[model samples]
Target chain A: MAKHEHKLEIFRGYLKFKSNVQKIWGVLIFLSIVTAIEVALGILKPPILMNYFLGLKLINWIFIILTIVKAYYITWDFMHVRDEKPFLKNTIILPLLILIPFLLFILLWEGSYIFDVMLDGLKEWDFDIY
Target chain B: MQASTLTKTKQKTWGGGGVKPLDAAYGKLMMWFFIVSDALTFSGFLVAYGFSRFKNIDSWPIADEVFHHFPFLHGVDAPMYYVALMTFILIFSSVTMVLAVDAGHNNDKNRVAFYMLLTIIGGAVFVGSQAWEWKNFIKGEYGAVEIQNGEILQFYDIKKDKRIPIDDFAVLQSQERVTHDDNVGIWYQSEAKLPEITLSEVMEGFKTNSAITVRVEELNDKGQKIILSREDAENKLSSATRVVKGANLIRNEYGNPLFADFFFFITGFHGFHVFSGVVINIIIFINVLLGTYERRGHYDMVEKVGLYWHFVDLVWVFVFTFFYLV
Candidate 1:
């Protein structure tokens, strides 16, 4: 068995907790607030955020970014990934960083291409066998 | 990694190894990798959803429309509220789980057990909420008509500016309608159970109705489903095949079958994770009550499951964003 000490600061050290239990409560409130914002945006669906950016809605981008931010807190704080050694941190995250973005790019690009092909309404939308 | 810590083993063969290479116990490290792999699998499902949705962008069902029914608020237009509540419940469970880990770190037996109990209750509640969501999805509220080309055409009231269920217009009678079972189909190709209202009934009902209009799955420039004129609705209804009541693997009252498929698969998979997390927590809770970790001088098991519980929460955030909010 080894002794473990948790770094009791979050928000890039802007917020600090004297105890682990307090930090856990703080995170729960923060996460609830973020989710509330997301739900509110979803319900209201402001016209300004409906504008498109890079073929996606600006509001959608905000939602995805907020989701990522929530994921970060859940992983780094709740899962204690922040306290892990640099080797462990890089190994865990670097693979996901490479793989997730690559897959998203390839699949979304191909999906859009398929959409274009289907839009043309040509019966034969298949690519060449080569 | 420091040079001083990198001591070369005197053995002839190099076995690149650290007892806790991932900066935790081997068990926790293995759990981390398991989570990473599971995350990839979930991402694959979601990306596949994105692919199908993009390909059918003009006709993909609006998630808010499909998932509006909250637990007791029947027929109420409460979109994203229930799922939001489920999200908060799951996140609060994750908080309790981490608190359990922190309590275990202090070797506080009573607190660890208490938090673990709360965490388990929270997880069970979240799973229950998801089951309710699936029930609502499977038993769709606003029934639609499926035409010759497999596109769903929903009915709307111009005055109300909202969708109307098939039962509102289509007359229900004691007709001898048989289920489309294996015996009834050509070449024994079984189909879903027969819907309540037939195509003729729907068409006739539409003719009698004055305010009802047909909403095509195709989206207009404003990203709203196109509501066809009465004459055009009749024109499209000429090719109507059957009345779709609810969602199954084959049929969906929602716009696209693919949308239903992804909804079931992604959320179903996440719900399974929450279920297993609760089971695992229960097992650990029992062990904590027995003072297993206290006897062993540490509480790494609590910490490992905390990681898993949090991962479940993390996945839900993404699922909520992509499935509902997006």
Candidate 2:
């Protein structure tokens, strides 16, 4: 009888941990707080809020970091990545890790070229009064 | 042959449990993998958008002026408020979806149904709001002059300190010189009505009115016209009346052409996702109601759809930031 009761307790706990409304509520509240902070920072544009400890513009860096955090949580909790195995997780993230950086690099390179072109054309880009 | 391939991929366990190391139940694993790939796609688009924005760093249109609309408040320059509200709505719906998933785990059918209904409503409302936003943008508020060079030049009333009508600048209306192939010689076409107040008329007005300032695209930032110093405005007005061919790529009367392009592509893309998401959600909602999961003894399907719904919300968060706020 005692063994049976212990087994029942473990099962109940497993069910609760696997899908608990309260835990989901906690995640929701935390996400809301983070979103509010982002909104406040975006609107206030606080001076001296550096993203890097040394030289980087803190606002842009912070935004990127916060976005990554949100992405991580959405994957882990909402998409249940924690329940997934190491091999499966690696399979999914490996491609993204390579592709996203490559895409950003290309965009930056092309964008700089366009910027130079626009700057050079400034002499003729000006308006004509007729 | 397919059976052999499946068995070959399914590795035998040391203890004879027969479960693979990388094995996860289909829905949960697929959802995670799909989200990962979708995230990469969104990041690519946004990074490209950022690249374009950086290229035009000096003269990018201000987010405040472009998306300056609020519900039930006309002509009130409220920026980011509506989009902010939409963000909150999406997040709230996400909360409800997660809760529904939780309820499903506990086998609480009633709670799951209620939350699912709420999520559907939130999605529908978001789609409606987006339609309204598109309508306001497509039917522009202030009318502008369509120059011969395919460029739009906005108007300003010198005396009223407001946008003037193209009809107000009319020295002579355009007479129809050619007819279309469809209506050739069938009916006499009338001339296009010209602005009532000509450039010379505007120049005369600017000279007399001390407060009047004429802003030109080439002269203004982002190629948008604004009232400037009275003397400078009058000087611009005194130039020759013959309008030149203005380029539409740089700047135009409807804010900026680039802004229009981004607005259509990004929002249209996001809206397409929302539409498809809703359709998918409806399908799954029906499945849930029919007790398919109840008989299956697992509510994993609900969890999968919840992931998709949350993803739709996630993309909106970035859209709200870049499109409306930044």
Candidate 3:
């Protein structure tokens, strides 16, 4: 089979590379910067982020979002999902987009509910079964 | 005769027809499917981790506190830095792998082999770093005491504002202790290896060191473990049952056993993936050096392996955030 031309722009055509290698490095730089920000935020843990957002630390939410950003670049650029047919791309990504969050929501929600019951209920865990 | 030609070209009717919908070869498509399924499995593990963390939210160990070590930086509090470095290594390897695939597309055999070699080295270093991290975790830092109620209590110097290892202040009791080996005890009734410090020894040391306070597993609203008042700490010390030094499948000095359990399972699973990816990269590297793809008229195999390598990196990004950052 013949090799096809690779689309070399990222971030909605804002950043364009002359060749496939250049695009790969460009994505690498973006990912590294994102990871640096995550590490910095984690280490510094600026006092402002100590506040809560939707029952989780704002810093944690920031980390989670940045992680997703990194995941996007890895999948789109490195895995060439960006170059795949739209139908193929959607088929691979959409199922996960729907399923993972649903799973997380149900499990985490239940977990916290149990936490509340334990906190409000009569007995303490105190690491003891009896 | 016409049918023979079609068979030789591997052509079939449309829909079984007109250009593959995925526009990818069967092998590459199968890899993608495998990655999707594998991704789901990892998500299940991580979500279970999150579930456990939330259930024990009051006393769960903080990520930074537990994984705060760097190589040769003994006593230095380097939180997230080591893991961040590991992330960079993995990401750099992924970049090299993609470059190899790009070079393969150009049929530049030498460049493809060189990049493949770099990818393999990067992956190996990542695996080694993970092993080191696991070792440090198994050999814990500040040992804690498990109370009769099951909660763990760690020692901290209020003046110094740092954790002190149990060895530092554990004054040995006057009485001698013995390991219950099969030879010394009733046959088949031997015991596990004895802990470095006994409950009485820890309590005695606590009594002698006035500055050291007991930090309970439960946390306050500020998200820090509640350090008991001096009198309360003394009272709590009476309940000490055993001295827990390091993490294991059964005990975790850090805080909850679940914390250590999840850390091991998730990172261990991810490390396994990285190790396998390195192995696969080595095999593919040999193929490139031998010009297998060159004779095949394409480097689709290199591209397929690149996809797998990148998927490994993607999983690590999530693991790093959840396991170390969050």
Report the number of the highest-DockQ candidate. 3
Which regions of candidate 1 deviate over 4 angstroms? A121-130, B1-18, B179-192
Candidate 3, A13-64: lDDT as tens digits: 9999999999998998999899989988988889999999998999999999
Per-residue CA lDDT of candidate 2, range A5-71, in tens?
0111112244333334555565666677777777677666687763345323576567667666666
Evaluate residue B252 in candidate 3 and report its C-alpha lDDT on the 0 to 100 scale: 89
Superior by TM-score: candidate 1 or candidate 3: 3
**Candidates by TM-score, descending order:** 3, 1, 2
What are the per-model C-alpha RMSD values against the true structure?
Answer: 5.7, 8.0, 3.6
> What digit string (tens of lDDT, one per residue) describes model 1 on residues B1-326?
11112124433222235444655676777788899999999899989888888888888888888888887786788988889989988898888889889888888999999999999999999999998888888888878898898888999888898788888888655677677677765788776656667877787788888789999999888789999888888888888998888888888998888888888899999999999999999999999998777866677789889989999999999999999988
The total of clashing pairs for model 3 equals 4
Top model number, TM-score: 3
How well does candidate 1 score on lDDT at residue A128? 42
Q: Sort candidate 3 into its docking category.
A: medium
Q: Which stretches of candidate 3 lie over 4 Å from their true place?
A: A123-130, B1-19, B183-186
For each model in turn, which proportion of the native inter-chain contacts is also found?
A: 0.87, 0.45, 0.85
**Candidate 3 colliding pairs:** B13-B16, B13-B17, B14-B17, B14-B18
How much TM-score does chain B earn in each model?
A: 0.90, 0.73, 0.92
Report the poorest 10 consecutive residues by lDDT, candidate 3 chain B: B1-10
Q: After best superposition, candidate 1 residue B87: deviation in angstroms?
A: 0.1
